[model samples]
Target: MKYPSTSTRSAIAALLCCTSLVPGQTAAQDAVQLPDIILDSGAVADDQTIVAEAISAGGKLTGDILDIPASVSVVTSAEIERRNAKDIEEVLNYTAGVVTNSYGADDRFDYFSIRGFNAYTYRDGLTLGENFGGIREEPFAFERVEVFKGANSAVFGVSDPGGSVNYVTKTPRGARFGSAYGTIGSFDTKEVGLDFGDVLNADGSLSYRFTGLVRDGEREYPFSRNDEVFVMGGLSWQPTERTELTFVLDHLDRDDVPGSGGFPIGYDFDRSDTFFGEPDFNFRGTERTTATLIGRHDFGNGLSFGGTARFSDGNDDFGYAYVSGQTATDANRSFFASDSAEKVAIADVHLAYDPQFGSFASSTLLGFEASRSESSNKRYFGPAPSVSIDDPVYTGAPSSVPLFADGETEVSGRAVYLQETLDWNDRVIASFGVRQDWIDITERDLLAGSSATNDISATTGRFGLTYKATTDLSLFASYAQSVVPAGTGVEPENGEQFEIGAKWRPLGGGTLLSAAAYDLSKTNITRTNPVTNLPEPIGEIRVRGIDLEAKAELGAFDLTASYSYIDPEITENGTAGNEGNQPARVPNHIGSIWANYTLEGDGARGDMTFGLGARYSGSYFFDDANVAGESDSYVAIDAAYTYALSDNTELAINATNLFDEKHVAFGGFYADFYSPGREVQATIRRSW
Candidate 1:
């Protein structure tokens, strides 16, 4: 019973030698049968956190997660080591319409929002760069974190109609493994990590894996600090058995003093650790490089083919000393500097088909994608030195901020797609999709020499339906469409969404419930001219939502919860007091909950675990006219503990914002963003 090696048995002996090349259909009708295209079903094995079922993210879908009718979330890696997650927006903080950090206590990147627009971050299914230029991701080199929410460009083509986040990497798993981790907390935090895998031969078809991380952290402002380094490597090749290939390389280095300016108008939250700049004049530096390639092949009655290619490069340098306005005690400063470089390239190809006509079952996919990106900037915006929010500050430095406004940008995209899914007997399911896109953009104002170019094209679509009356309930409906690319010359903003959902998995199936109601919209949208902030193409937006989710595992208890309610409007506005308002910050109730419990007993108290969490946000608005500058509602708490020092060591402790809630997680048209206070950590891990 020697299994694994992706057991395709040389693709079933080349489908029985292709039945003599299909002549006269003699070898039992050319004996060919194959299915199981290997899509996700990895990761969850470190004492499982109960994932029940998954797959179906950008791995181009192949069921489970209630047969995907949109709105997806998977955070595994045992929920990022039980929420000690350090980035990727803290692994989507309880996800459901999502909004994480949104520009508050930054960590060089990852500012989020979904369902109310703006989202980007993908990595195994490509494009892990560019989201306003600083893309940083390294949640211990991911092994899960997928969020799909609205409009995925019908299979990730042009992106951002409120959703898309991938990150799945952590490859090469053929056998022998090792792991190590260490962490220590509270501001002077320190961390170390490593993971390794092996199987360089012995006919096991070659394998390799490595992941690394080193972090030295400190933040709560006041001379901020955070230095990070990460490295990842992978290689896997199968030779034949319908072939498989994987290669990946990664690198990231960052030096930080980020979270630059925010907090001025009346500066509340008890001053939230005020720091009017000049901890030697602020800083942010980064270097990133990545490469990826993945391939798969299989051919039998149910064909299959796969591909992925990615390349990324980033280099950024930042400087800041800002707080532009404030009085009662003086505060008015500005100094910005930047140096940038970003490059990205992506490619994808696909072909998949699974068929059976007897009881009618089907799965089909076709794809093509290409992308190119470039960004270059050198900026400096002057005027500094003015402090005292309550008692003065240092003088300027970093050579006193000088060069201003230089730019360059380039973007290219191409796409093609087709998808289909159908099943009639297992209780009727249906799916359909179509996509087309073309985009080109170039811009340069390198100190006002001026240059611009634009091209656009679009088509997007999606349709879904699912129904399964019993055996754990299910009902769904969906409609989606999206198109972006707007600005250089205009035309290309359209978006659409419509959804209805219900899913249940009661007692026997153990707990998992979901609900959704949505109406999303976007159009034209480009308005800003409070007297020459320029850019106006009128604007329109609409968002109406309701989403709720629950996940559970009962015997030893584990739970997760989510809720969201949106309702954002700005339906057409070109100023005039910001027609309809309510855009900045977009929040109308967002909730989260988490729970965990475990006691186990290897005969005499060996394992233990406990966790609790909570988060809520509501208030909104901070600009775009809607006056009085809102942003008040808040709540936060988190806790965790784990111990299991036996079979292969483990110890954990985690906390976030626990009790140190400073209100306003974000609300900045120009200042007001907090949360970077409580964080306590402790960890030790070992495995073999």
Candidate 2:
């Protein structure tokens, strides 16, 4: 893909040429840290470092060190490797203000919430909304993960301030080498992976990397198994110093034997209990497949472009067998049998410009994106004429019933956006942006010949300002708006957010701290009954919260801590009085802390490192009505130790959930599951 040309580049070059009029001036003397600038793919300036670059490079982006007006967190690759994080949920659990939930025995159908807003997974800055069936991400291919908290409407156009996550992928760097690792963990889990990369010539012109991983494991529940394999490869060509190109391909195949539905909250907060209708119900197994392709090009000018295409195919055939005492059904009764499939495609283009007009410096960005996704759900129910408890025999005939209707739904979206930032004297900055989007949804029932379609168009805007109060402190504020179109009978809602904060670094670059207060409100929410087709006031919601974070490096020790407080309320709703009820699943308090110490040695048995971390979350309402709630307040501890066994080999042991806190991580009336309890793994790696 290619980006359209603009005058910003030529303008910058002309200005640079005219600078010669100044006598006794040198290029080095004139070069300054360009403010409010955006560069194309590989054109990022050496002096300008963004949070995204920090993530992709396995480094830290301390709040006090960067001038970004919002709260941004980085999850480095070293941390992921230390924790042996196998998936996005595992990696994010340690992050502040993030929560995840999984249904049934499948980890592929997980849901995520960040800062009280639903922030689904994304790849290369594009949302992958087709995950309902089999669309999922493999963490091994990612270099790092970045989380931007608070409103992101200015950069992404339509995003909740609750937060947004971006996964940065690994790229080939024209080197020839190979590495391998093997791990054994709890539940008889065993995994092995190999990563190999090579350069075709000495001119640094052609290179490629191939990676593959295979895993087999069993869960803590009965009849549940995890088996998966992933493979990926990429090719790069750098024909000239000013031009570079890359193509990447990846594939994933997974199979899992269904366990019972996730563990449910018992009357007494039991993490081991399954609260569904039956215990012996069988849920069969599932199979999932995914493929992806990505392309990127960078021109040395202040501009670059990239694109990605992906397809996923999955099949899930599971039987939900339940026993009903009210109907006097047989002990072995299956209530639901279903299979599902989905497909998705996404395309994007990016542009950036940096120019100086006298003392005023500005950065401009323009982008366009389009995506299409489709999904189908087919279900079959067994026949049972037993309408009452007196007819137990009729319910025993499993094959007597007819087929049920098959349900299918398709959704697609297209969007375009523009954003610009203006800076003054490295002390003040302002940004503005706007976006427009169009979406369509369609649903059909095969048996009933019933169909429905919904279309929506919306626009959003963002504004932000930052002022340096002193050399050690900065003040910032922003306002942004977003929209989430409803599916089925629901109407779209608009979300508005305002944030004000200050960042302080008392010890200059050694220690960093930040505190922010924000308010988020949503309007035009839809509450509609699918069966009745009646519209009701869904009401508005407001979330007020404060976030605090600190990071410091002293000697050989690294320490980090963060805390967040939320008071989400339903300001207006038809079903419930506007008496400030807390939003469902949003905890009032959350916090996390981690510390790592490194030990250096001069001998062949080189260095060693030890790390410890813990996370805590407060109580939350499980239901929308707030009648029933879950006190998820619990502390989880993790410890890791790594040692270099040789010059090219290492060994490590990691233990997570050290306390075995049997607390509920996430739950709902429809599904409930406990967080994974105490798991330990040991790994051995060799590199060349």
Q: Which candidate is the best by TM-score?
A: 2
Model 2 TM-score?
A: 0.81
Candidate 2 local lDDT, 1-688, one digit each (tens): 1111243234333333433322222433442322323333332221122122222211111122346667666665555776777777777765666755422234545456677877745665666542344345677887667777765544554455577777766667576555568788877787777666667788879988776677767665554556666767778888876555666677665655444444323422233333332333344445444455555455544565555555555556655443322222222334656677767776666565667777787777677777787778777776322232222232232443345868788878788878777879768888777888888889897778988888878888888788987777888888887776666566677787888888776655545677888898877666775667655547787888888877666777767788888888888887556457777778888888878787987785578978898878787877667875564677789888889877567898888888776655545443345666787889997655
TM, every model: 0.32, 0.81
Local accuracy of candidate 1 as per-residue lDDT tens digits, 1-688? 1121232334334333432333332433432322212334542342255354565454576566676777777777777788787887777888888877655685667777887777766777765633544566777887777787787677776666677788778888766665566787876766667766667889878888877766666676667767676778899989877888999898887777667466676557343356777777688878888888888888878988898888888888888777777777777878887888888888888899988889888989998888898888888888887887777668858565667778888988888888999988767789988988888898888887988888888889889888878757778888888776765766777777888888787753547788888888887776556787545668777888988988787888889889999888877875455767777777878899888998887768678889988888787776656774777778788889888877566899999978887766655545566766788899987655
Q: State the displacement of the C-alpha of residue 311, model 1, in Å, after optimal TM-score superposition.
A: 25
Best prediction by lDDT: 1
RMSD of 2: 12.1
The reply for model 2, stretches above 4 Å from the true place, is 1-65, 101-108, 130-134, 157-161, 257-259, 262-334, 380-405, 469-474, 488-490, 504-512, 530-537, 576-579, 664-672
User: What is the alpha-carbon lDDT for the whole of candidate 1?
Assistant: 0.74
